[model samples]
Target: MLLSVFSCNSEPSIQDQMVDNPGDDGQNENPDEGEELSYKEKAFATYEMIQQLYKKGDLYKENFPEQNGDREYSYLWPYVGMLTAGNVLYELGYDREILDKQFTGLEEYYDNRDYLPTYQAYPVSGGATDHYYDDSAIVAMELINAYELTNESFYLERAKTVTDFIMSGEDSRMGGGLYWFEGQSDNCTNGPNCMKAANTSAYAAYVTSKMYQLTNNEAYLTFAKRVYEWTYTTLRDPSDNLYWNDINIGSEQINTTKWTYNAAMMIMSAVNLYEISDDQEYLDEAVTTARSAHSKFTKVTNGRIFYPPNDSWFNVELLTAYIQLSQYDSKTKDYVEVFKDNMDYAWENARNNEGQFYEDWSGNNEGRFYWLLHQAALVEAFGRIAIYENQ
Candidate 1:
């Protein structure tokens, strides 16, 4: 579902790139200015195009007539796509009728049998079940966003329910981090075993921080700190300040891959903690990681920033966190151009004839099949960029 972000192991000398919002002197703001398509327009175009993936208002596995036939993969990712893509549509000020269709698709993901949402569900039926803490946490965070968007209690209660389920996946394992899966999952040696993944735990921390803000619940804050510190201490790559992918508590195995989302969500969580606690240290941590990760992950193309193509769904956390960090850290504002340029390049070069962008924005792997998650990721990316431009 996710990938390990590959980066050179060698750490370069990192500077404190904290920003203070420079005053204009001809080197002003806005990167995608005067383009044929406004950033919002491009986002809206992609938003409308992605709705075609939904089947009877719900998206299932892509069942091309030749490839998988009509059989749905029934995986959890399409829901992630829907939640992300739906939020982008809302942020773009799309019509409520268009947004409601997405809302219904998202609503279709919940499993009502036990009043507990699971990972995978049939498209229309919304039944059949498996639970992944990471998957539900992704939904839990979006449920709060939906609650914000709709001002509805149903979304709020569901957010709380999903958060409760995420909590159930936690134990005092591996110096105190949450488990990756609720039970036995595919591709694991032992059945029903849990892996302490950095992305999952850090994302849960981020979600709990939001929940704390939502309810003013000290318990959520306490848990957030527990998860945050545990992730920070356990998975952080001290060499470069980036983060590792996962750790096997039983064997003490550490997957040293430096993933973007794991660090991005941690940065976002740190920003939230700083805002709530008024702690400068958290802000410093957020800014430092944002600066260092941006340098480590991006390459220059015709002097424009280019991100990795394999798993862009993870990039949403980075883009969203960057938008959040830029508001507080002036240093992060400079990177907005990098974000915008990537979007512009993706639109010009990576998009398919069908309007779906491949996961690989580099276009070297254009043959890779189209995925809703990839399109959803860019929708969120462009949506975040739209937010920055509006700000």
Candidate 2:
């Protein structure tokens, strides 16, 4: 019983854009000045938030609530929110006890036997007709992360189940991208053209590379390479180095509207492909895309990336891209530092007094849970950077 709270049509209040000071000069303010906070401090803060939301056997109750005689659970947003939080915990060196608890809650919701409407108001609600390809793929990515942290075959097995379902023979038309929902006979006949489709493919590629690293499985490597080729060739805008959000397979027109997350996914996919293959082409693609995105969206003021116009989720994704590229190319140090500066800016300017981020720093609040999920990802990215610096 998932409640469908469809607030997508409403515009965000003007207060959402109310920042205290947009002209603050924090870039030259000394990186070591801010309380000397370690990654552990940030990770623990995020972990405590998770624990407060999910405790005892009452985790499912929070996920599926019955308020005012009506079921009040959003299908996709809550699930993705939990998955993002779980990944942050995993990256912060949390134990399997927490992982098991989170995984159990996700599995229960996904495994519900009752039938419901497929196209509910919720974005990722699952039902007889609903086939949430991207949301399910995100869950798979989280499971894969859990497997990496816990060495648990169960997590890997669950991830494989999700992959198999999406990769089934039903999705042969859209060049391997996942559909948003089921039974669309129009432009989405093959699948939804959302950027999440590309993101899912990229996640699969990354997971496959990791699996190959662990098992030396040539099959996984081959699959990874194939998916990488498809995504880069199809979704990538070679001219602008940015990716479109959707593609109309029927009209053959690329969804020219660019998004920060799509660019981040392209960066991640290119980096993983380069690592697995050690091919200069892949590395060049990654570098080219990163530099292009930086030039287009980021400006350096006081030696820091300043006032980037995009979503907060891209802040973390861009950081991860910078870190990965820096491993192969030391010249990315300057860019990586810029990324850190931008992240600090986000912490100061984007977050509300309640420590929550709006959907878009540019003042678009669709009321989706993706903004919160992005905040969790930022915590994970910072934690990883902290660990790397310490090492």
- The residue-by-residue lDDT of candidate 2 on 1-391, one tens digit each, is 1123323332222122212222221122222335545666655564465444423352422221122322334344344555656665556666646566666656544643243211222422333224444455556667777777778798787666665554431244567654343334123433223222455556556656656665576877787777767777777887877665555556655655555555666677677767767788988887887777777777655445553554455466666667777877787667777666655554444544334433333322322222234445555656656655762
Q: Candidate 1 lDDT, tens digit per residue, 1-391?
A: 3211111121111111111221112211223334687767777767667666534334544421114223444345545766766776676787666556665666565665465554433333534445567778888877888888888898888888888878766676567787666443323443223357777788889889999998998989999988998888988988878898777655677867776788799999999999889999999989889988898988866556776656676766788888899889888877767777777777766655566665556554543334455667777788778767872
Residue-pair clashes per prediction, in order, are 3, 1
Could you say which candidate leads in TM-score? 1
lDDT, residue 228, model 1: 91
* Model 2 stretches with alpha carbons more than 4 Å out: 1-36, 50-71, 112-129, 169-176, 182-197, 214-219, 299-304, 307-310, 348-350, 358-371
Q: Estimate each model's TM-score.
A: 0.84, 0.72
lDDT against the true structure, each candidate: 0.67, 0.53
Report the CA-based lDDT of candidate 2 relative to the real structure. Answer: 0.53
Model 2 Cα shift for residue 331 (angstroms): 3.2
